[model samples]
Target: MTIHELSPQRSAALTGVIPPVSTPLTPDYEVDTASLTRLVDHLLAGGVDGLFVLGSTSEVAFLPDSHRKIVLDTVTHHVAGQVPVLAGVIDMTALRVLDHARVAVEAGVDGLVATAPFYTRTHPAEIELHFRTIAAQTGLPLYAYDLPVSVHSKLGGDLLLELASDGVLAGVKDSSGDEGALRGVILGRRDRRDIASFSVLTGSELTVETALWMGADGVVPGLGNVDPHGYARLFRAASNGDWEAARAEQERLLQLFELVNVGRPRMGLGSSALGAFKAALYLRGIIDHPTTAVPQIPLNDDEIARVGKYLSASGLL
Candidate 1:
């Protein structure tokens, strides 16, 4: 669909199984164009509704701006009308983020995933202003990405509603795993003043069914990258009001998370989660190897072994 503006309804329609897709790389750690195309095709064919380019899984922070642009262009091109491609417009500063948003616009992305600013201690008011400025510049519907554990600011529902009131952000992907906070964003305003039919996506696949049940309009999950069918099943079951089926799938996913996320540390390094996820994909024969960029530490044999064991025991291998 030749979309010029970010379509919230269109996005929701593509929501059930959106993968925070990995940035495919060659052995030497270059963007593997062929692999990326194949990966996108595989995901779409395997039942992923859409794809998220440059998310945590995509290693946006590790990639240079130019490479980020190329990655966006490649994914958007390969998506080729089969599904919407949401590009992550994450950067160090507001100006740079605006620049990235412009790149996303030029690259033909369906939407922009703008996470909270990191490194600096940004206040709630300033965070509000930052999103306002970026939204004013891009005019693309923005998906507020709130992974407080990874970013600069801790988001509350009040801040999200404030931004939505200004038409600055269209929706949120609350990776914070705080159900109450997510609920606030969803039920913050009923007047539909600024943005009518606002959206909120849950980034926590482990609790995505719960989030959706709690009023999340969409879900953008990392685990969906590895197991799109499973996530899709969960989303469909939830939407169909099949509580029993949804609960069953959720239990299965929780079991998987317990295995993969066991003993995983919370660090700002950006490599830990990505490494494990890539290794999981590798073990599943989805990728060749898990090659992180410079300054990003590669998972040692022990860590890989843990991930391997997790997958094998879960019967994913």
Candidate 2:
């Protein structure tokens, strides 16, 4: 596959609500291309600025290489340049991540997102070298994913700024849930005269309004898969400086986020939350089956009912 390049103008437009889109699967755990296309259409119609595939919300870690390729191919082909498609090359090291990054680049993804290496104990200097090396090798716009819960490493604001200044990172996806760190990155981008157009997107769904107010360029909410229009409305409200409207919308979305808690006591955090997102999508008829990958428990009938209640209460059903 031939890798295409994105113009500076096109790369600069990577802002607003870009969902870490879920990878729909058949009962046999095969990639459901048709359903994935539908989901992309759903998000595009809802006014999202871009599509992020194979991220945490997409269950990238669980997907086999073939399934990951299927997802990247399907979304990139379907989107057809209507919006930027950012693919996540998540792995435990630079070499493995580069393999996936090559595939994404060949698939014509607008950019790549990856977190610091995991599984083995690594140093901050190593993490910096990891990103710098990947950026140099791929020659594609790279975004640092600060997902401490999953990656086990919190990408500090200082490192993030240094990367931006050095042109090693095009942006950052801060899911660390640390308000101080998030603010630091946002402020760093704002105050830095050398780094221009470094996007700082918040993956903190519960506080989209707050992140935006704190100078975040956009949001990559997992809940956006369930309620894309809602996030779109919230983004526009906040971006327009209408805090009152943004607050109301965000509060409603926060209520919707409560659905993730429905599976907490019985299932692991990933199982419960991801299953709820899939279940909600299934219940809304957006996808065929809510079945997640193996080893991760699926939401039972009772828990699925709770998801429906959340949608209904949010005026989605």
RMSD, one per candidate, in order: 3.7, 2.2
What is the lDDT of every predicted structure here? 0.75, 0.90
TM-score of each: 0.87, 0.96
Candidate 2 lDDT over 1-317, as tens digits, reads 21233322224626899999998999999999988999999999899999899999999999999999999989888899998899999999998998898899889998899999999899999999998878877778899999999889999899998888887888999899899989987777786667767899999899999989988889999999999999999999988889999999999999999999788888888899999999999999999999899889989999999999999999989
Worst 10 residues of 1 by lDDT: 1-10
Best of the candidates, lDDT:
2
Error (Å) of candidate 1 at residue 64 is 1.1
Task: Report how far residue 272 has shifted in candidate 1, in Å.
Answer: 3.8
Candidate 1 deviant stretches above 4 angstroms:
1-14, 189-196, 259-270, 301-306
As a TM-score, model 1 comes out at 0.87
Candidate 2 steric clashes: 0
